[model samples]
Each structure stands twice: as structure tokens, then as C-alpha cells.
Target: MARIRVLTALKIKRNLKPGMYADGLGLYLKVRPGNSKSWIFRYRTGGKLRDMGLGPFHTVSLAEAREKAEVCRVMRLKGLDPLNERLKEQQAKTIEAIETITFEKCAEGYIAAHKAGWKNGKHADQWTATLQTYVYPVFKDKPVAAIDDTLVLKVLQPIWRDKTETASRLRGRIERILDWARVMKYRAGENPARWKGHLDHLLPKRSKVAAIVHHPALPIDETPGFFQILRQEATVVARAFEFCILNATRTNEAMGMRWDEYDEQAQLWTVPGVRMKAGRDHRVPLAQRSQRILAQMQEIRTGQFVFPGGVQERPLSSMAFLMLLRRLERKDITAHGFRSTFRDWAAERTDFSNEVVEMALAHTISNKVEAAYRRGDLFDKRRQLAEAWAAFCAGTAPSKP
Candidate 1:
């Protein structure tokens, strides 16, 4: 037997004090704080309680709310989920609005929304470039809703193996655009460009398709010889490259170093959070050789930057180190590969702890538990390590502690 309806139209009109008023058969008229009112349908499904919203009391009358509740009750009796069914009906209505937006329009909208927050300016250009080059030719004019798995496969399949890296990046961009489309109600259903569980079955893994290639690095023993040649060059780029190798800093860090970042008395160069790859401030201890470079840099320093380009105010171009390498006729090795050279030298020849070496390179600690306990930066220990690295590059023995 069903319970009698506890709430009437008159009762709902009079009582408005922030509480649930039952209408029986899983229908409820709830009053919220500040005298707001709404209808809810509560039911148990698969041993879990679920509450689905009906229309608000001001819009839906008692009889109308009861009618919606009855439909939901009937759905449960037939072993279907009414809440999920309601969503499907709502989604169908949303698709009616989505059909007008095309894939290209949606992709442009997504890029526009995200461009400001992206770190690199080239990233914004790449988003439009990749889509224009590959994806736009196929689906540019088509409605986002019309992009199915088959259509997406048609766009990706030809380049999947031959241009594996580009194809992988394209697939990710397509998936992100499709996801944004779904959220904006310009599309519906599962993302057709999704890789895991969907496209994984269709295409081979990117690793299997693309050959692995590492950046060329100088052999550990060969660094001192290279350093000797590097020291002889009078160019700012040469000095920057030598600073990069000594501190195990990236090219950007070396080139972007400014006058304010250095503490002359403390002998530390602090890379601010904004400039660092991990978005954390990294303190690089100045070795005797690095300090000597800084002293020479100060004598000729034109503007704010330690390594000025042709213009005094601006830092060196990002390609400066690579061009320097090319000029030296050592085109086989990249500027970034110097970090690996530092790591190799540390592992093979030094007695310093691995943490100190990694810290010198400003690599993020991967072990969470170990990192948590390491509250101190071990700057003194790292100073010793940096000094040793400098001595090694100078073709001298590290002084015994």
C-alpha cells in the first residue's frame, strides 16, 4: 500500500522554512535557505540511493511533479534507470542546438579560449598550423556532431605510421577539440578521437611506430678537451655555453640570466619560478670558473642580461648555443646534450651523492617519499659538487674535503 501524500498545494504555499516536504512515492518538495523551492525524485537503484531533480515548485505544480514521479516509477519497474534516461532525452535536445557548429569553428574557439594561458607563443601557432595542414582538409566544413570514429580514422590513418610523432600530436589535438565541442554543446557522445580503449584498438602504439632517438652528447672524458676549446672563443655565446656546461643549466637558463638574478656576495644565481621548467625557483651555486665568467661578463655587460644578443637590452636568441656549436664544427652534439654529459661525468668520476648531482641539474625529485623528507636543498653539499665539476672541466683534481 502507498502512503498518503503529505504535502498539498495549499501546504506548499504556506510552509517555506528550508526543509523537505514529502509528496509520497519518491516525490519531494524541498525548500532551501533564503526561501528557494524545488522538486526532487528520490529512489533506490542497485543498492544506492539517487536523487534526481524535477522542475522547481514555482514552475511545476503538485499534479505535474506527481506525473513526472510516476513516469520515473514506471521506468524502475521495467528495470531501466529513469535519471539516465532523462539525461539522454536532454542530450538529444542539446544535439539539436549543436548541429550548427562546424569542427573548424569549434577548433578555433578552443584555441582562442586557451592561447593566453599557454607558455610558448609557438604552441598557439602550432594548434592552428597542424589542424590547417592535416585535419581541416577533411572535417573543416563538417558539423562537429558529424565527426564519428570512422571520420576521425579517415583523417589520421594515412599518417599514423609514416609521420608517427606528428600523427600522435594531431590525434591529441583532435581529441581535445572534440572534448571542448562536447562541453560547449557543439557535439555529443564519447569523443571519437580518444586514444585509450577506443583508438588503441585501431592503431599501433606511437612508440612501436616511431624510432627512438636521443640527442647527441659529448663523451664524459671528452668534455674537458671541449671545455678547453670553448674557453678560447671570445663570443658571448661561447661564454654562455661554458656557463651552461659548468652549472648543468639549460640553454634558456644560461642565455636568460640577468644582472638582478646574481647575488655577487653570496655567489648564487637564482632562476625564478616563472623562468624555470618546473615552475619552482632553482638556486645554482657559482663555481670558481663560473664566478670568473660572471666577473668578465660584468666588465662588458651592456644591459640587464648577462649574455646579451646584438641588442643590449635583450637576451641572446634561443638558437645561440646551437649556432655556436655549429660554428665550432661540433654539429654532432646539441647544447641540451651537455646536461647529459654533466650527469655522465658525475656518475663515473665523482664520489658525490646522486641527489646532489640531480639537484645541480635542477631535475625534479621523482621519489615522493624521499623528496618529502628532503626539506633542505643541501646547498653546501651541492657547492662542493659544483666546485668539483668546475675543477674537472679545468683539467684539475677536485680538492679533498
Candidate 2:
């Protein structure tokens, strides 16, 4: 007869390494790297050896592991495989976890698991923000399995028409979160938040219901006049704005510009894919005015960013342009609208092809066939267009029609 209780609680704590230590009767303590320990039941069923995990050392005590091993020994005597029985027990626990998990809990888990793969920090933040602001208010503590179509509709209808774009994005985000829940086994049925074949029948199509509102832009003729005043402001943000307009780039792109990205001799500014909306590198051909702006910025250059913010060692705040606009009493127009202004001027004044103009603005072509056919960035044509645009913004008549 084998002696029972061969292992004591003190001995379990003393033996710590990266191999299995046997207690007796096929019960072993597996110690791994980082001092992590767990209990395992090692047995031979038929001709194969099977190792079944009990629980972690911190959770399952020596006494408990012995009791579980005794149970497994009895099952083996009855001609039952302990490994198969352990899997069945795990399945039961997984079912319990699925039933008890709340929608918010599942959402948090999903974000934590996937946010690292997102393009930028802002996108990850947007995922959490939308879910918390809109979805959480409705299903704060509800189990994901209990979420239904009516509850989802209740979250969307209030903002569906008034804040159409935000509401649409929110709906899509909720659908993704619910889909994740189903994949995680927290929910079993078809996603209630799904737009196609489900919510499509309930709410009006977004395109039909939501009114499209373009950002307010300066008229083609007014750009020169606005810049004349803007040039005299003598502020870092003002110069940043001028550089942004001259390059036909976004506010964040201009604010986040770095000195190393500029090639003085080549006269090009390469915006990295991380900072771009399309997640691809964009090469901006610097016009004379753009280079001049860089020359002016060189005198005050202090940190990594070409235009440093009010705080130390950070890029300029995105709101700097908007605040500057407000101070200039141009609340009607947005900094982003300058891109549209450039587009309008290019279409109205220049003989340049739409492709060249769109490329200058770094606009992604929505038509797949058109995008596939377009290979080059048309750098030379865009350079000509940029120089002409700079001239127009500086109150000079374009040399080309």
C-alpha cells in the first residue's frame, strides 16, 4: 500500500523550478518560469499518458488537489478517462461564464484584447468612448445574452436623425462589440445590433435620413484676403496654419510635422503613415511659400514638432487653429475647410486633371477600379498645382489657366 499525504503544504512552497514534482498517486505540482505553479494529474489511459490541469497554486490548495486526484483515481478504476471528464467540467464552467458575463464586461474585454492592433491611439479611444457614452447608458449591467433588438433600437433612435454620422458610427461599433460577445460565447443568437437584415428593416437607411453637411469653406476669392490678415498675426499657430494651407494638409498633419520629415534640398515633406488618415505615407511637394514658412519656423524651432504646443515637448493642440479662427472672427469656417477651398479653386481655375488635384489633397479614391488604374502620385503635376495654389493664396494671379 502507498502512503497517503506524501506531500505537505510546506514542501509545495519549497520546490520551485521549471519541472514537474510528484506528490504521489499521479498528482504533481508543475512549476514554470516566473515562479508560476499549478496542479496536474498525470495518468496513463490505455497506452497513452495524459496530463490534466487542476487549477493554479494560488487558487487550488494542496489539500484540494489531493481530493481532486482521489476523485480522478476512482473514475479511472471505473474505466473512465480523467482528461475527458476534465474537459467536460471546463465546458460546463465556460457555459456558466457565458451566461453571467455582462455586455459592458464583454465590451471592455474586447477593447483590451484588440486595441493594440488599431492604427492610432485616437481610434482605440473612439471605440471605448462611443460604447460608454451611447451603449452603456442602455445596457449598463445587462447580460449580453439578454440584449435584444428593442433595447438596441432604444439606444439609436434618439440620435439617429439629429447626430446621424456619430449615431451611424456608434451603431456599427455596437454591432462589432456584440459580434465579439457572440464569438466569446457570451451570446448565442444572431447579433441584435446587426444593421443588415435586422435593424435595416426597423430604422430608415442612414443615407436617406441624414442630411449631408459639408464643412464651411472660404470662397476662392476670399482666401487671398484672409491670408493677408493671417500672415500679419506673428504667432506660431498662425504660421502653422499658413504652412497647412500652403501644403493642402490636415490640421493634425500640420501640427504634428517634424523637422526630420523635411528634405530641404529635395523640397519635400514626407508625412508618415502613422499620422495619416489612410495609414499610408504621403509626400508633399513643398511650394516656395511652404519652404518660406519652414524658414520662418526654423528661428523658433525648439522640440521634435515643427510647431510646438503651449505645453513643453508636445505637438500643438488640434484646437489651436479653431481657437485662432474664432479670434479672427471666422467662426463660420473651419481649418479643415481649407482643403475644400483648395479643391474648389483647383477645379474652377486650373486645367489640371482631377486626379492630380485629388492626389495633392491626399484624398483616397473611393472607386476601386479608378484607384487600381491610378498608379503614380503624379508628383510633378501636383508640384505645379501646389505652386499655383500658393501664388493664388498670396494674391498673385496663377501663371497657368
Candidate 3:
């Protein structure tokens, strides 16, 4: 019989020659010039013979190499190309590894890749915040490839109606991330967060599901007393809060107000279209008290924002007014509800036109016909109404402060 398994483990380890040594059954040891030893199976397929490397000698011992060589021998005997079979095995493993990528990893990748293109810097932060608050708690660690409609619904159903806008945004964001995963070959199939055809059937339309929520407003008759109490505090937030109520602006608009947006000469604060909810520039006519508050802020103006937060160079927190309410033992009310109170007062207490009052609140006119016809913001009339509002809050006749 021809020599088979002739090279012992000790001889294989000790031999440092740069040549191939046959060990029967087409299995041979390849010793490179650098003293690296590996196992190879010389086989004939079609008309030519070729060498296929099994593995390195250090990791695959003499016995292991023989076993792999025997398998390749059997494959060739069965008329299969061993090299092609190994390539297929490798590709399958690579796809399996890619499939193991997690949803959190994909989300982070998506945010990092697209945040630069977003106009607002806070957009990235909001994406991360919402994912952390909602999605991560549910299935962030699960494989991205495994995510489906059932898992997606679990994340949105609880907050769907309670936080309609946020839930809607989150669904869209998840859809985008899943799409990204598909493009990267991490996942495949229809996106579970897709709304129109897939999720629409499972869930109600956002508008139909979301009930219009009215913030708890203070009684119109008691605003003057509440204003008097708010005036007693000398904090920067208190002054900013007072300015907000005087203007009848939204919480975000007031809290994000910058000194640069104000024009002292005209007694007007022009909120840029970027800051306005309607995406149009809004001119707010500052009243006498509001002007006084501006003067006070100008004295201590440390940063760009009119209402500087505790942190340097940052605006006040959204919760500042709510916290202020808690401190004054008025937890029954909300800062946003003050806008409703202003609306009620304008209707019941003042003779101001609906157009002027709505303009003061910077509310988007839902009536398309009326909005089209109304051109001017009625700044002069709004100024008079603002002064009247201040007087009512002060429990004094409307006067120039």
C-alpha cells in the first residue's frame, strides 16, 4: 500500500523546508519559505488538477487536516466542486452575521448618517430622545432582521392617542431606520412601520385617533389675582412667564425668544418664520409691561436668549413655567392653557376683533377664505389690545407703563 499519514505531528511541526510533501490520498503539507505550514488537498476537476488549502497547521492539527481532506475527497468523488461548495458556505455565514445586527445599532447609524442634512440641530437629539424613551425600552436589542408589524405595534399602541404627534413621528422614524437596514442588507421585506397600506389597516388614522386636548386653563375672572401672585417672584423665569402671558404666545415661542428678535424702537418682536409654528414670520406688538420686562432683561442680559436658563448660553427649559406653577401651589393650571384663557378673555372681556386676537396669539387661520382676504397683521390695533390686556392683568385702567 502507498504511504498514508506518513508525517507524524512532531515531524510536521519540526519540518521547516519550503516544499510540498505528499501524504497519500492527494493530501499534502505545504511548507512556505517563511516556515508557515498549511494542509492542502490536490484534486482533479474537469481536465486540470488544483490545490485547495484546508487550514493553517497551527490551528488545524494533523488529524483535523486529514478529516477535512477526506471530506473534500468525498465531494470530488460525488462530482461536486469542493472549492465552490466552500465558497457557498462562507457566503451563507457572512449573510448570517449581517442578519444579527440589532435595531439600536441601525438607529444609531441612521441618525449619524443623516443628522448633518437636517436644518435643525435639535432634530437629531429629538430622534435619539424619542427612541431611548419609547423604542429602546421595547425591542432595541432585537435583531433588525426580525422586526415586524407585531413588534412595531407594541411600541405605538400605548402612546398612540395619548401622544399622537410624537407617536406618528416615531413611526415614521422607525420606518426610515428599517428601510436603511434593508438597504444595508441587514434586513429584508416590507417595513413594519409603513403607514399607508400596512399599518393603516391595523390602526386608526392619526387625526381620528387623537382627540383634541385642551390644557387646563385658569378661570378668566381669576387671572388678575394669579398675575399679581406671579409678579411677586423676581426670578428670570417669572419675568419671562409674565411676558408670555402678556403676549398670549405659545410656551415654545416665549421660552425660545431671543433679544435679537425684538425691536425696541417699534415696540415689536418679530418671530422668524423658522420659529413660528405656521412657518411664517409673525410680528408681536409689545405692550407697555412687556416693554418694561424687555428693559429689565436688557439690564441683566447675559446671553442671546431673553429668558436665559440656569445653564449658560441656553434658553429656559420647557418645564420652567410648569415648575413655577407647582412652587406657587397652582398645580391645577398649565402654562399653555394661558393662551386659552387669553382667548376667552378676548371674546368675553374685550371688544377686539377675532382677526386681531388671533394674530396676537400667532394662531394659524384655519378658515382659508378669511386668511386669504386678511393681509395686514393689524399691528397698530394689536398694540392697543396688548396694552388693554396688560391693564386687565394689573387690575388697572389701560395705560402706558
The C-alpha TM-scores of every prediction are 0.72, 0.79, 0.62
lDDT of 3 at 31: 94
The 10-residue segment of model 1 with minimum total lDDT is 392-401
TM-score ranking from best candidate downward: 2, 1, 3
Model 3 lDDT per residue over 1-401, tens place: 88898888878878578999888898999999988989999988888998899899989988998999999989988999999999999999998898888999999999999997664679999999999999999998999999998899999999998899899999999999999999998998899999998999998898898876689999988999999999999999999999999999887788899988999999899988777778788899988899999999999999899999999999999899999999999989998899899899888877888878888888898999998998898999899899999988998754432
Q: What are the clashing pairs of model 1?
A: none
lDDT of 1 by residue, 216-315 (tens): 9999878889989999999888998899889998888888899999998999999987678887999988998899999999999889999999975999
lDDT of each: 0.89, 0.89, 0.90
Q: Rank the candidates by lDDT, best first.
A: 3, 2, 1
Candidate 1 structure lDDT: 0.89
lDDT of 2 by residue, 91-122 (tens): 99998877888988888888888888776678
lDDT preference between candidates 2 and 3, better one: 3
Ten-residue stretch with the least lDDT total in model 2: 2-11
